[model samples]
Target: MSLKVKFDELKTLAGTELGTSDWIAVDQDRINTFADATDDHQWIHVDVEKAKTGPFGGTIAHGYLTLALLIPLWTELLDVEGVTTKVNYGLNKVRFPAPVPAGSRIRVTGKLGDVEEVPGNGLQLTADLVIEIENGTKPACIAQPVFRFYA
Candidate 1:
């Protein structure tokens, strides 16, 4: 469930865990679509038959595709209310620790790392986010995402 809080309540939750998001599948169709969108037609991500004999044993989701998922998954964990504008400021310390095989399920867990005041009556929030592959030994991705919320 998402942790809903007004803009002013943000700072108080620093160091708190927002929660884990519902698992979402990273199927071959989804991977193909992402590849098409990004014009990244690497064989490991698009050519399923060839990928079966490749390093990971099967087609795998692109690392950036998994990273892009943070947007929607984040909404499943946090809802900042009463903010006129919310921005995905940027990312920090991003790492793809493991591969996400196509047809696998993935979920995210996030912690509120910090909240700081910024210019223009806004708050800068940093979230330590981890994306885990179902039944996988290591996380698919780890990222520190920064968001800017304007009242």
Candidate 2:
């Protein structure tokens, strides 16, 4: 595990890799639960037998499901100290470059891109996060996630 640092220290890390998260498995159960919650029971995501004959050769997680994992992955990777509140501003850009098949392990590598000071002792951070799949040529997702933290 990496040591936690104060939010101010993050500013010095601009244009550098902040951290990488531990591997997280994208299993069938997780995919099914997401599909159930979102009412997106697409054959490519849920039906293993059908998906085997489909394009991906096996059941794949939904792109949104992979996107949602960024939150937890980011949390596991870093911590912001001395902040009264931290909120997800939104993504500047997001792309699902490749599908993550069931049982595949994935992790996030975050690079601190830009950090700007806002009014009221707040800071806006833009992180370029890449979700890398284990043993896979392509990443599961790539996104520029933004956050606003108030001290």
Candidate 3:
């Protein structure tokens, strides 16, 4: 389900899970484009033939590509109304526990960890985000992302 809340209600939602994002496929085309844009044409991410025999047994997405999908996935899960600005403050920690094979489906689930007030009538939110693959045992990515929202 999607979460819609005012900026002020963030405090009340601390230490709770917001919601999970809709599933998104990680296709070879997407992996290839990410490799092209980032100039990271690693064989495991682009070369289908070579990657088939590679570690993951197929073309896998770049870790950062998986990481970068979090924000848009967040949009599917939650929407914060009554905020003038929202800034991606930074990440405290990030880890890739498993590889995301090309053509696999993945989604993110976010848990609100810490909520604190900042200067200029702003709120800082720390969310523990988990990206899991469809029918996969291990999570593809886990991260703690900090966001700043101004009222």
Q: Rate the local accuracy (lDDT) of all candidates.
A: 0.96, 0.91, 0.93
Where model 3 places Cα greater than 4 Å from the true spot, the runs are none
Clashes of 1: 0
RMSD of 2: 1.3
lDDT of 1 by residue, 1-151 (tens): 9999999999999999988999999999999999999999999999989999999999999999999998999999999999999999999889999999999999999999989999998999999999999999999999999999999
Best by TM-score: 1
Q: For candidate 2, lDDT tens digit of each residue in 47-136?
A: 999999999999999999999999989887668889999999999999999999999999999888899998989989898999999999
Tens digit per residue, CA lDDT, model 3, 83-132: 99999999999999999999999999988988999999999989999999
In candidate 3, list every pair of residues with a backbone clash. none
**Judged by lDDT against the true structure, how good is candidate 3?**
0.93
**Which prediction has more favorable lDDT, 1 or 3?**
1
Report the C-alpha displacement of residue 1, candidate 3, in angstroms: 2.8
Q: Where is the poorest 10-residue window by lDDT in model 1?
A: 84-93
* Candidate 1 clashes between residue pairs 3 or more apart in a chain or in different chains: none
